[model samples]
Target chain A: MKTKNGMILSRYYTIADFEKEEAFLREQQRKGFQLKKFVLPCFYVFEACDPEDMVYRLDFAEVKKENKDSYIQIFTDCGWEYLFDVNGWSYFRKLADEADEDNEIFSDMESKIDLLGRVTKRRLVPLAFIFLCCILPQLVLQFTGMSSEHSETATFSTFFFWFFAAMFLVYSALFIEMGVGLNRLKRKYSKG
Target chain B: MEEKLKRVYVPMTETGFYILFCLQEEMHGYNIVQRVKDMTDGEIVISPGTMYGTLSKMEKDGLISFIREEEKRKIYQSTPLGTEILQLEVKRIERLYRNSKGETAVGK
Candidate 1:
């Protein structure tokens, strides 16, 4: 099928390549072959042809608005195996064409996730600059004979001076080491 | 006198290099991915997402230009300045090879 932009839908199928096996399974189903009683420890597998290993199964149906051919499969597995299983399912519903525009959390999540991503993106350079901008100037004044040793002006400046000085002394070497290590890892993993 | 080669900023990636290299033949994104994988012994794989992203960035930077879209995928080729930079990079690598040859020969 071609869209408005003249783009054709390319269908690609993967997994369980033997068509004959699928046909046989379908034929067996059509013939009313019932094996429910014979199979004692059976599992209701929605996605797979025959049932395998699983716990309790629930039956529920919901409409998918994106694509008309899409459907969902929910699997209730035992233990913490649910963590490894994909949570949500999306499918195209039959009435998707006539459905109203629904609420979207994606755009909101996208912005929040984007901020988190950028915040953690590049830290070393800006952090170093912040330290340089705030702390470096005070240290300069202390060692340069520009220290205001008289009255309250000297005391207040000296207090801030030592605070930044202590912070710089403690954090500088550690930050530099971390920065170098990060750059090395970045270069090593860099595809160029 | 050595010509002062202008630097071109491509994405700093193996996929970026392969994409730029394949554009010497004016191929599309999927074709570039296949050709690059074939050339690199399937060691490097360029995801469709990365390919399109890099292509857009390169086009924005004027290092690549789109020729036409065929069968949905947009075909692209290197610009004249892009080709010039490729040649300069080739020369740089050749010079490095020559310098390494002397160093290797010294130990032998």
Candidate 2:
């Protein structure tokens, strides 16, 4: 047995990148570093093990605290080892050898699309709402004639406005990217 | 409601069919999976993601209802609508099976 001691930090913006995340973890496992735990947002701790192919899957479930066990038990009983949950996303991994033919957490295309739809509704809809309703309007107002009348107030407001505008652009780009990725997934499954 | 359900769920997916069948006796998620696997002789295995996703959708569609909670496990059983739909699916499957067999064994 290889000595188990390794830690890696990674950042994934949205649940739509779940496939990429799973691939990354699978690659790491191939190199004998199995993910032991995941810290919220962007930290993954791994342990060394015999090199083996593993399948990692992510499910975005905002399970109630009371229902957490039963939610996890189903996966555990089905030979999927529950790794961790972060930000309403649950990570599960199983040895490749043990998995059934499909090896997917979702068996049917309709259910897979539905799961992605849930993630989109839970995570993307709110972001899209904020961008369309709040940030975009504020940015438009700031760019137009909404500057403060007083020079001091105007200078401060202008600085803050530009700062927020930049942040909003970054956030908006992320939201759009996530939306496109999710739409692609939906289309892929819907087509299948 | 029955007509609408038949239209929506007539040709049920294999996973959905087995799940509703398993829920006839008020089983939890894990138990439902086990029962399906046993009943199908390992031919059908509903993963956790698929199971819960189907359960949530079925519940939202009024096809199933939560029976009670037992130590953090939520017991669910098919509602009347679910049972009706399951029966419809069974009959549909039976018709398909019978037709296919009849077509294959015309001479025999």
Candidate 3:
């Protein structure tokens, strides 16, 4: 969507759906909206640019602040334009002609696997911890309370029970989706 | 060599090996990437992400030490331990090379 200015602000990406996110940026660039930067929780801002087919790639690395310059320098030297990073997800793009045949930010299978590992450890692991420790317990407790004390605060308990249950389902779905996606990527990259 | 360091660096990936090897002389991540691409005749171009990640890992593992900053690029060189680890890895690669050529060990 475009604001009064000629800039486009999109909010249709998720941490788990990075493949789609990269594609989304490429599509936008094709539509003449070049990505300028991003805000957290899925807002990718772009400015007007000449329509060109470029390849966008995302790399998940927990780099230190002091090392960020050198981190970007490496990519800049290798012909990738580092747009920006949000939450350890660095956004980069290169001309389609410049990218290698594989068109990947990682050259080796080991580094590809390493990127997946970082995503899992940084994203999925913490979500799993929240699902197991916090969400699940609250969900069970709310359900029990709703069933047992259906007298005074039945409506209140029922609301919370459903709320926690919905949260449980959402978290479960996210976890499974990302787990499967990452595993599929790992398996795909591991083969040759 | 320490067991932990050996396990980490001995079976180093090509990215890791080249990064650590090139750090024998102080160079930043981009320089190493260019050097590796040129060395391999562009057969093995180390992507910038891999180069940065490997350099950070080696720096943290004490295999490479940061020397100074030049134009916002941090220069690095192999520590004594890093050079030692590189030597071990080179020897291992030499053995693999010889075996690929079907050469038997000459003397113990």
Candidate 4:
């Protein structure tokens, strides 16, 4: 971990990997760094601290700006410190102590599964819709030469198709990854 | 309608049971957590994620209804439907406890 100006910037794509993200943050805390804020598109800002074991958890919520304060107050009142919100997900941490139950921000399997379902609806569904409804049709049209073209628009059209194709590939990978992660969490919780 | 509701909610999850139990009186999300903690003597603690999710689902299912807001916090209480379901659950638990205690045989 490198620190300059009292903050360390680390990059991690944690969109669909909540458990991995929590483990990463916990490891950082164990190394004497605590996460301060999360910037969009994978930047985590950390502040130096004494090495301590901290448990980090993520929750997906659609809190409007007006309701944000009360929403956070609920968590804070329950002993979970509010760290930051990024992309509709809230990050929280608590000290890992002798009380085995304190480490979890979710107490029951049903609630854990519900949280994953919300995350799927909020983040993954939209990406999947775009990939299937928008990008796939355009790609098919381009490949089949069914899309009308003119000399003037040919270059721009070709560039646009390739750009969208690349984006579709990336979104497709993300959609599948997120779907799988949610399913795994659901299965794990449903078993118990 | 009541019979159907009971069928759906008879086997309440622990979290759902606690949330409905706490909302017997009007309270906000945070207050419900504290109340449950106090009632259970720290044996059960509902996390914010679980509390909020349960509250939302209960409200949507008509098991709970929102009262006037105290500032930005939404106050809620169990509806008649919620109370009926909770009572059924309590009776079910009571029977389980009584049977397990050998006061009555399992099939009797």
State which candidate has the highest lDDT.
3
TM-score for candidate 4? 0.85
TM-score order of candidates, best first? Answer: 3, 4, 2, 1
- Interface DockQ per candidate: 0.02, 0.62, 0.70, 0.69
Top of the candidates by DockQ: 3
Task: Tell me the docking grade of candidate 1.
Answer: incorrect
lDDT score at residue A27, model 1, on the 0-100 scale: 40
Which pairs clash (backbone N, Cα, C closer than 3 Å) in model 1?
A67-A92, A70-A91, A70-A92
Which segments of candidate 2 are over 4 A away from where they belong?
A1-4, A98-102, A145-149, B1-6, B68-73, B94-108
Residue A133, candidate 1: how far off, in angstroms? 3.5
Q: Which scores better on DockQ, 2 or 3?
A: 3
Name model 4 segments beyond 4 Å from true: A1-3, A146-161, B1-5, B68-74, B95-108
Residues forming the 10-long window of minimal summed lDDT in candidate 3 chain A: A5-14
Report the lDDT tens digits of candidate 1 across residue range B1-108: 113224434223455666787888788776776787799896765643345456666776777898976544567899986676666666666766978778554565
Evaluate model 2: give its TM-score. 0.84
Please provide TM-scores, in order, for all candidate models, with all chains considered together.
Answer: 0.38, 0.84, 0.91, 0.85
lDDT of 2 by residue, A43-150 (tens): 777887899999999998667787788888778777898877787889898888554554788877888887887788888888878888988787777665435677
User: What TM value does the first chain of each candidate achieve?
Assistant: 0.32, 0.88, 0.88, 0.86
Candidate with more favorable, higher DockQ: 1 or 2: 2
List the candidate 1 regions with Cα displacement exceeding 4 Å.
A1-123, A142-150, A183-192, B1-17, B24-31, B38-43, B47-61, B66-75, B83-108
> lDDT per residue, candidate 3, A1-192, as tens digits?
776544756566556678888888898889888888776666767888889988899999898788788788878877889887777788899877754543677888888888889989998889889889998898888777886655766777788899998998898778788888888888888994
